[model samples]
Target chain A: MALTASDVTIHFGGVVAVNGMALDVMPGEIVGLIGPNGAGKTTFINCLSGTYRPNTGTALWQGDELIGLSPSALLRKGVARTFQNVASLHDLTVLDIAKLGAGVRRDRRTGGHLLDFFRSDRALEELLMESILAPLELNDVAHKPIQTLSYGRRKAVDLARALAGDPQLLLLDEPVAGLTSHEGMAMAAAVRDVRDRHGCAVIMVEHKMDVVMSTCDRVAVMAAGSKIFEGRPAEVQADPEVRRVYLGEP
Target chain B: MSTRHIAIAIGVAVVMAVLAVVLGRYGAYLVNAVAIAAIGALSLNLLIGYCGQISFAQGALLGVGAYTAGNLGNAGLDGAVAILGAGVLGALVSALIGLPAMRLRGLYFAIATLAAQAILEYLFKILDPLTNGVSGLVIKPPSIFGIPMTSDESLVLPSLVLLVIAWLVVSRLLRTDLGRAFLVVRESEIVAKGMGIDVGHTKLWAFLIGGFIAGMAGALIGFANRLASPEAFTLDLSADYIAMIIIGGLGTWPGPIIGAAFVVLLPEVIQRVGEAAGISDILSALRELAFGLLIILFLIFEPRGLTALLSRIKLRRIGVVPPAGLRATGEGSQSPEGRSR
Candidate 1:
């Protein structure tokens, strides 16, 4: 298995946001996590990404404990994530963000970034431009500042940034939440393509049921902070308890 | 930066060197003052403008350089070596001042820097043996190689050369991965962390590099005046540099040089204009008032500074709508809103 996270629990003051959540994903498998608002779908992903520390749990990635590492440390270990909202305050070009992603992925054990002074970055820039930006359709506006782009394109840029590092475990939070259907479909296809090319494990937390059903290899349902149902997409849709809790059926 | 940018820098250096040689004594002195101020402003811009770490201890930091160079020169070291020693010490001291910045940010980090300035100023007054107390230390006119640079005309060359070096170094840094990391840290540290950038490390580098340049400028000031005094480096001096960078264009590369010249020359121009207007009797009193008023007006009408205003005018020449109020956040910047700078 690529990832095995079990018995994860967290609380914010008096509220338990995620309670005893467990999940496992094999290499190259795509796992979809879906639930209603305030159901801790994002909270659980946050735990895995090192944005928050769960009170008690163990997340083993290839037998390494992954709970306490920083987000940057996790990136060094081949883990990366995409945010739900791409901040528009940054005025950098799409290529700039891609370069930043690629920069952190380099094994800087010898001299750190000090040797970056002597190194020419032409090859890295060209590689990111061709391999990373081209596939996501971001090559057209690769030089434009991200603040000038439309919302959908900015979302694509965020995905491009994550994939720049060639992550082995990709955690995506609401990748298609604010996108139009056309953009959403394109983002879904890109995720599938990434998995095929990299053979990396993916755990996507999203609200769009159709995209989840079509893209995910297996579906996990959560309600009130715990996993309520786990099965294939077809099995998940037919389950009566999932329908009542997730779809508001009486 | 491109090869074209490098070419333009060399061209400017050559032209400025020629002008410094041709100008009279007072003109050389004025050019030296502006060049020194520009170097200091460039350092501040790197911290607050590019790295998003606001500092108010710049004046004390410069004082730290001045005193170090003064002591080194008095000890019989070469002038160039003294200046470089000052830079190394300044970098260490700046990293010390930036320790709080590893935890504080925005207005709070700015306040911590303010406290640091106050403390350093006090130290300069009380460190009698080293600082020569409130009386200041008299610096020997150290030689560059073997030639004594006793006149303003002779000193202008070193000042201009250092200015060019500082400019190119800053420009080159922005193109490197470390420089891009600075911009990301500026936008938001949380975003920086998500991208696997160590926020503390980037901020520390900002302080180190900026402090080193400030130290070099301070050493030049010590050599120029032949003294290092507590009064020469004060809270007001820090405010003057902050004004220079802000009025020039914040993070814009040319902002510091343009702002420095304007700030240094403004009083001289006022004095000349007042004399020309036959108001010599009251001009001295009114000049300071007018200067304060102009700064206030600029902040209100053009917070983005003269760089943005000039660019706007250039764009207007071709019938394009000028985005006049956008602060120079970084390269290719044109944001609708302004930050705390």
Candidate 2:
């Protein structure tokens, strides 16, 4: 398994945000986490990404415990995440943000750090333009500051940033939450493409049913901070309790 | 740098050199003042503009450099050794001040720096054996080989050389990964940490680099004035250095130089105008008032400083469109909005 998180539990005041959340994903597989609002899907992703420390948990990535590492530490360990709300940076071009992502990659080319003092970033710029920005269809506005882009384009930039690192385990929080249907479909396709190319495990917390159904190799359902069901997408849709609580079937 | 940037730099250098040779003694003195101020302003800009750390201890730090150089020079050390020694001391003192920066930010961080200034200033007076207290110490003219650099004309070249070195160091550093990390920390520490940068360490580096430059500026000042006095570095001097960077344009490489020249030359220009109009008394009384008003006007009308204003003019002349999302108001464009999720 690429990631095996078990008995992950966290509490905020008296409320248990996530309790006994257990998940396992094989290499190159995409796991869709689907649930109602406040079901701890994002909370679980946050725990795995090191944004929140679960009070009790065993989150092992490739056999290493990821309980107390910082976000940057996790990133260096080949784990990266995208925010639900994309951050709009002033004075920084889309390409610049992508470069920042590429800058932290563990396998960055030799002398990239040292050469930055005396050399232009043209080579890395070209590489990122072709590999990351072009795939996201953000090449046209790559030189423009991120704040100038449309909301959908900004969301794409966020995804591009995460992908630039070529992470082993990608955690996405509502990657398609506010995008149009076309954008959402494109984003889901990109996630699949990333999985195929990098052979990385992905745990995507999303509310879009069609996206989850089409993109995920497996599905997990959560309600009130605990996993209620785990199965194939079709099986998840057919589960009686998932149908009653999440799919709204009588 | 591109060919165009190189050409511009060379052109500026040639103009300054010619001005130094042709201008009378007073002009050379003024140029030296501009150069010294530029060094301090540039260092302060690194902390305030790029790293987003407000430091009010620059004046005290300058005093530290000046006293170190002056006392060492009086003790028969080579001028180069004194200046370098001062720089090393400045970096150490700045790192000490930066310890508190890890726990404070914004106004609180600024207050801590202010306290550092107060403590250092008091130490300068109490450590009378080293600093010579309120009486101050006389500085010997720094010599290169056997030639003494005594006159303003001679000092102008050294001052200009120091300024160029300061500019080159800062500009080069800004292009490096460490510089980019500084910008990230300034924009958002959370994002910086997320990207694997140690925010505290970056801030400390900023302080160290800034203090080193400030120390170099102090050594230059001691060389120019032939004295290292406590009165020369006061809270007001620190405020002026801050004003120079703000009025020039923060974060832009040329901003400090431009701002320093403006701050240094304005008073001399006012004095000249007063003498010519036979109203020296009135103008002397209003000098401080005029300085305050100018800063206010610039802040209100051109908050990005002269650098942004110049760029806007250049863009207009070239008929190029400004970046689309830039806000209409000058002050709004400078705000750190949309920096965080």
Scored by DockQ, the top model is 1
How well is each residue in A1-250 modelled by candidate 2, as lDDT tens digits?
A: 8899999999999999999999999999999999999999999998888788999999999999998987767888899898888765655578877887876664333434445677777888899999999988999998777776878899889888888887899998998998999989999998998899888899999999999999999999999999999999999989999988899874
lDDT of 1 by residue, B66-98 (tens): 999999999999889989998998899899999
Q: Total clashing residue pairs per candidate?
A: 0, 0
lDDT of 1 by residue, A31-72 (tens): 999988999999999999889999999999999999988888
How does each model score on lDDT?
0.86, 0.81
What CAPRI grade goes to candidate 1?
medium
Give DockQ for candidates 1 onward, in order. Answer: 0.62, 0.41
lDDT of 2 by residue, B1-341 (tens): 34444455556556776787788787788878888898899899999878988889889888888888888877877777777888888888988888898998888999998999888888887798998888888888877445578888887776777777777778667655667777778777777776656677678788888888888788778878888777888887888888888788776667888899888888888888999999988987886787678778777766667877777777678986566534222222333332121
After superposing candidate 1, which stretches have Cα over 4 Å from the reference? Answer: A107-111, A248-250, B278-296, B322-330, B336-341
- How does candidate 2 score on lDDT? 0.81
Q: Tell me the spans in candidate 2 whose CA falls farther than 4 Å from its real position.
A: A106-120, B1-3, B145-147, B320-341
TM-score of each: 0.96, 0.91
Residue B28 of model 2 has an lDDT of 81
